[model samples]
Every structure is written in C-alpha cells, then in structure tokens.
Target: MIAIQNLTKQFGATTAVKNLSLAVNPGETFGLIGPDGAGKTTTLRVIATAMRPTTGQVTVAGIDVTHDPEAVKKTIGYMPQRFALYPDLSVLENLNFFADVFGSPRAQRTELIARLLGFARLGEFQTRLARNLSGGMQKKLALAATLMHRPRLLLLDEPTTGVDPVSRREFWDLLTQVHLDGVTIVISTPYLDEAERCQRVGLMYRGELIACDDPRQLRANLGAVVFEAHSTRALQARKLIEHRAGVRVASAHGDQLRLLLDCAERAAEIQTFFHANAISVDDWRQVQPRLEDAFVLMIAQEKQP
Candidate 1:
C-alpha cells in the first residue's frame, strides 16, 4: 500500500534522512525505530505529505506524494509526536472538528465517532474538555480526532511516547484494531518493546537505515549463541567475560546478564570464565537472539566518520 524509493531529505549541510527506502503492506504495522535525531520523524513527515523529499519518490496507495501531495494527505491520517487537538474543546467537539476537516460524510460521523470513542474508552468523557482529561485520556482524545476522518493509512509519530504503561497498551490495542480494519500503518518509535510488536521494523542509525526486517528474522540472522548468567557479583561477571575469548556482547537484564558468545571457538572459554568466577550459569544452553540485541549489535558496528 506504500512504496518509497531512495528517499532522501536534507537541510543545509546535514542530511536528516539518507536515501531511505521501504514498503508498507496493507494492514501491516511497519515500525521505524532509532534514537533521537535519527530522522524517523523526517521520513514520516515526507510520507505524511507535511514535508517534501530532497530526492526519490513516494507513492502512497498509488498517489505520488510529490505530484499529488494533497491526494496523499486525504488518504493518510497523520498524528504527530505532539498533541494536535484543541485543549479547550470537549472530546466530542475535537473529534467533530477533525471530522469536518476531513469532510467526513454526515452519515458516517456518528457511527465512526461512536466506535472510536469505544475503542479509545473515551465514550463517557465525550462531554469533558480535552484539557481536563488525564494525560492518557488526552492522548486517546488526540488519537480519536485523528481517526475521525478514517484515512486509509495512519502515520503516527510516537503516539505512545509519554503515555503510561496502561495507556500504551490501550494505544497498541487501538492500532491492532485499525490493522484489522485494513488500514496500513507506519509508526516511528524509540521504544524497543514497541518495535517487538510490529510486523516488521526498520532500524535507523545516524540518519541511515541499518537494518530492516521482521524482528524475529533480524534476531535469527544474528546467528549467535546466548546464555543467561546470574551471579551475586554481576558486575564482576560482566567484566570477566566482556573481553574474554569467545564473548562478543554482554548486556544486563535484571538480575541475569545475557551473553552472546562465539560458540565455535570460545564456548569453552566462556564456560571456564564463568566456572572460575563461581557464577551460576543456569539455562546455559544456547538461546535465540532478541531484537534489542540485534539492534545494539547493528548500531555498534556502524562506521564512524
């Protein structure tokens, strides 16, 4: 439902996005992830028709953004990283205003608004002013306003960033519902956990796309052996194994540390280091790589200027 080819965006001497290209299938939630200043928003803005690309082309549902930006705007609902609703307006009033902007058919307003209110659990708060709502409720109101138009594609830029955990879950549920309703969605987020929920994720680094694939597939491609090591002196264990032969990476996960070791040459070395340190390595068997591990590994390998 969406196609981008060698898309590039720049400002002055710095490039915000560098020839980024990807596709989003209908009903799929494609996530773009990176740290701050990685150009996720710049890319999203291009797709949202809020900004023009420096080069290349973007076709959303067959409408060329460069040639038919207005058409692309009509077919895509864009929710920016910031709240876009009128704070003084009542929840229902905010939705009504956006519905008007989208020129939603009179016959469709009540039904669509009602369903979104239910999906966002804002039905009872319709009459309340948006400013009076809790942080989570306000976010829901913003999402409801964006959905009132029922655009075929959703370009959400970190819809759940500041939301509480419960609110985040609610937001994800709403996204799942939208996918079920056949809406193509592209979202940019910094949260790795959110990336795990996506059908496929593109990892961006320093304005360049480093990896793009299903989270599971990316992890599968790591092709490294993982083990959970727990010890009272966790820091000591980490230090001992970090530069030790056979260990490529180590990250602390709660009380346990995940170790990525070279199974062929250094598995024995890893075991020896752990045993000598008196750290209990339970579940010592090789385990699957994770998306976070894959991202960290990918970012660490980036060539520096």
Candidate 2:
C-alpha cells in the first residue's frame, strides 16, 4: 500500500536518509528497526508527507506523495514519536477536535467517537483530561485520535517507547486488533522483540536499509552460532572473546556472556580460551540466534572498512 524508490532526505550538509527504497503491502505489519540517527523517523516522515524528500519518489496507494500529499494523507494515519495532543483537553474533547480536524462528518462523529472510546479502552476515562491520564492511557488516546479519520494505513513511530512493560504489551494488543481490521501498519521501533512481531522488518543504519526480511529468515541469515557462558566474571569473559577471531559478536547478557561464533567448532575454542584465562566458566551451552544478534552483526559488518 506504500512504495518508496531511491528516496533521499537531507538537512543542509547532513543527509538523514540516503538512496533508500521500501514497500509495505496492504494488511501487512512492516517494522523499521534501527538505533538513533538511523533515519527511520526521516523515512516515515517522507511517507507521511510531513516533509518533502530531497529527491526520489514516494507514493501511498499509488498516489505520489509529492504530487498530491493531501490525497495521500487522506488514506493514512501517522502517529509521530511525539504526538501532539491538547493536554488540557479531556479525552473526549481531544478525540472530537481531531475528528473535526480530519473533517469527519457531523452525522458520523458521535458513533465513531463512541466506538473509538471503547476500542481504546477509554470509555470510563473519556472525561479525564489528557494530562491527568497515565502514560499508557495518553498513548492510547493519541492512537485513538490518529484513527479519527479511519485511514487505511497506520504509520507509528515508536508508539510503545517509554511505556511500562505491561502498557507496552497492552498497546501491541491494540495494534493487533487494528491489523485484524485490515489496516496496513508501518511501525518504527528500537526494540528487536517488537520488530520480530512484524511480517517483515527493515534494518536501517547510516541512513540506509541494510537488511529487510522476516524475523526468522533474518536470524537464519546471520550464519553464526550463538553460545552462552555463565561465569563469575561475565564482563571479563566477553572482553577476552569480543575481539578474538571467529567470534562474530560477544556481549554480556545478565550474568552470562553471549557469544556469536563463526562456527560450532569455535565453541570449544572459546571454552579453552576462557579456561586459559582462569575466567572459570561455570556453564556453557548453545543458544538460539536472535534478531538482535543478527542486527548487531549486520551493523558491525557495515561499519567495517
């Protein structure tokens, strides 16, 4: 439902997005994954028509974003990283205002508002001011406002960021409901677990899409074996193998040192290295590759000369 080709966006001497291209199919959940300054937000802004691209083409449902942004806006809902809601306005008031802004028909506004209040689970708190609501409630209210026009596609920029774990789970449940309603979703998130939930994920780094695929395929493509070492000195163990040959990536996960090796044979060598260093590994076992592992590996590879 969305298409971008050779899209580039720049700010003076700096380029936020460079020669990027992507597509989101109808009814699909596409996740944009990256660290800060990875240009995910800039790409979303271009698709949302919030800003004009420096060059290249962007279209929503076949309408060129540059040629007719207004028409494209009509078919998509964009929830920016920091959505603007009238804090002084009550939940119902905020919804009403956005409905008016989107030009919802007077005849349908009441029923729409009522349904949304229920959908967002703000029916009882509809009279509460947005500033008074909990963080999670505020997010839901923002999402409800974004849905006022019933756009065909939803563009969410880290919608769950800063929310508590329970609230984050609740928000994803709401997104699942939206997806079931046949709305295509393009969401940007820093959390790899969130990206795993998408039908496809695009990894952005240095203003370019370095990898894109389903979570399973991406993990498999890492072509590395992961092993976990439990030791009293996890950090020291990580330091020993982090720069060692055949060790693709080494990181500390809680009390364990998680290592991605070039081959299973490297596991025995890593154990011997830890033994020789007197790091005293208490346990060792192979672990499944994770999307985060693949992401780190890919970004590390990209940084190589």
1-305 in candidate 1: lDDT tens per residue? 89999999999898999988888888888999988999999999999989999999999999999999988988988999996778889988988888888888999788988988898898999999888988888877777788776789999998888879988888888888888998988998877889999999999987889999998888888866777766566666787777665667877766677787767556667767678867766545556677878887777668433
Model 2 per-residue lDDT at 88: 96
Supply every candidate's count of residue pairs whose N, Cα or C atoms clash at under 3 angstroms. 0, 0
**What does candidate 2's lDDT look like per residue over 1-305, in tens digits?**
98899999999998999999888899999999988999999999999999999999999999999999999999999999999999999999999999989999999999999999999999999999999999999999999999999999999999989888898888899999999999999999988889999999999998999999999999988889988878878887888778899988889977888888899998998788778878888678998999999999999899989
CA lDDT of every candidate: 0.83, 0.93
Off by over 4 Å in 1: 253-255, 264-267, 274-287, 303-305
Q: Top model by TM-score, which number?
A: 2
Every model's TM-score = 0.89, 0.98
Shift of residue 245 alpha carbon in model 2, Å: 1.3
- The lDDT leader among the candidates is 2
